[model samples]
Target: MHSKIELIDMSKKNPGEPGIEIIESPEALAGQINKAEVFFLKNRKVVLGIGGAILVAIVGFAGYRFYIDGQEGTAQNALASVVYDFEADSLQKALNGAGGNEGLLSIADNYKGTDASNLASFYAGVALLKQGKYDDAISRLQSFSSSDLLIHARAQSLIGDAYLEKNQPAEAISYYQKAADYEKNEYFTPVYLMKLALAQEKANQPADAVASYKRVVDEFPLSSEVVNAKKYMGLLEGQVGK
Candidate 1:
């Protein structure tokens, strides 16, 4: 009987087999390293330039942040000096400054990007409103922005007050609605809603006024403005019925 023997094929080992390994010769490995070195040398200038640019950008941003921090501190100090004038109702002195201290207008105009400058705009707006400069008040108030929920809503409400003083009930209604709707909560929403209803009434929108007032009464029953809202709503309902 003839015996049959099968030889293992080392060159054609299955690539997917678990234990299969391809070992590179020293010459092949050296050639790959040489190619990588050549590529790095060829693009050395480009790589260095990109790295330099990233370093410069990071340094420049850090410097800018440092400068802004210094400016904010200065602005807050300047703003603090004028707060007493504003609180005491010395509107002109607050707006224009007294002695050597900077005023609201200067802080707002000079500081520009600082938080104190933004607060100066708010204070200046209210000062202008008290002075009966409604247009100027609106301009300053519109320029002021805040992330504080209560303060931001108060700014919107103040703009409505400015428009109301200007005898523009339509404009007043729009701003009042914005105040009432912005970040609605129990503490301030009722006050804004009351203003909105008053603006609606001024604009001859009795139904809208009643609805706004009803919202204050129903949505914020515990609010200080709730009693006024209920009284206004009842009056509006009677007026609408007539």
Candidate 2:
């Protein structure tokens, strides 16, 4: 985006022109110090032009930062209103908006770079999931990024569920594995593991399916997943036996 300009002047004459020779560094010419001054002026002009470009770049960057900050503030306020509606169990109002307040979907669509906007995407995804709009939920949830391990894990698991409900066993298994391994928290791990086991079985990898279910029984014995894991494992083993 940034560039510098330079000029090179090399002058020479044909040797046939009365003992003429090549001239190197015209600035070093015997009696043309004045010409050298002109060359220096040209270099100065180029440097000044580069300096002006740099100044404009700095001003542009400052203005962009200001614009982004303003957008972030607006998005935060919009998201707050949506959250209030959501907490009141007014799901439609939270997602589609009401009166003067913008909803989570609107904020996510228009102010994607803001923190509140990112959270809006998550909220939108969860709302869609609750409404059984699985594909739409997956799109929004996958767009959200967060450092919160629990939320991230939940999103991954939800994606797995969506895929599973759609009968896409391979996709379901991938997302389930991501959810199961993401934060390694004891609470959600078994749930995701069971989902993965079911998905693997659907994918027809009976051995891998059994292994996944066995993990829940062995490593998460107290979890609710353990009961279903045992059942699923038994089913897979029986199929293999046949």
Candidate 3:
């Protein structure tokens, strides 16, 4: 039997009233369910996006660690081999290497992205310089760069020496200035300062030459370059007044 329904008086209601109604239609109910499912799907997408980002981060970190560890290992081994040849003064063997062994050139070529390769480039430049291949030395040294202050400064000094050997006094002076400014250490600083002063003298800039020599003598009196600096300073001083 149908349940009994009760109705309150509605005579006080305004005209054209649509009356109170309850939503029980099947299609309307289906639409509500569809909306709830859509909301859940949207939330699922957000969760998936966050999970994907975290997964990418984890994978990237692992890959970077592996790459760094591999590079470090390779660098240690490569440096050891090169150091042996360097100590023995085996320039040709060091650069070319024996069969089944890699040389500095191989390291520089095969491991270009690694720090060891960068160091190999430096050694190659030094080797070329020792062989009196000034142009090749300059090219190799100029192409190598590093963030390590000492290494970077030494490279610039080596490049300056290459230019000096090539009889390019102006270029040598420029590179010497760069080396001196790169590292504020007692060891290389005075040496580069002396070179700069000498180069300035060669370039006919006696005033600049005197200033550079004075800097070496005043700032690094105990350095080996200081003695030479003092003599140059005296000569430049005498010339300045004339």
Best by TM-score: 1
> lDDT: which candidate is best?
1
What are the clashing pairs of model 3?
Answer: none
lDDT per residue, candidate 1, 76-118, as tens digits?
9999999999999999999999999999999999988789999
Off by over 4 Å in 2: 1-61
Q: List, in order, the clash count of every candidate structure.
A: 0, 0, 0
Worst 10 residues of 1 by lDDT: 1-10
Better of 1 and 2 by TM-score: 1
Model 2 per-residue lDDT tens digits across residues 1-242: 32111133324444456423224433335436666677768798787889989999999999988888999998998898789888877878989899989988899999967888889999988888878899999999999988899998888988888888888999999999998888786788988888898899889899998998889998888887788789879988998883
Compared with the true structure, all predictions reach lDDT values of 0.89, 0.84, 0.82
What are the models' TM-scores?
0.76, 0.73, 0.70
Between prediction 1 and prediction 3, the one with superior TM-score is 1
lDDT of 2: 0.84
156: Cα error in model 2, Å: 1.4
* Tens digit per residue, CA lDDT, model 3, 51-115: 99999999999998788678767865977777688668898777877756788888877776677
TM-score of model 3 vs. true structure = 0.70
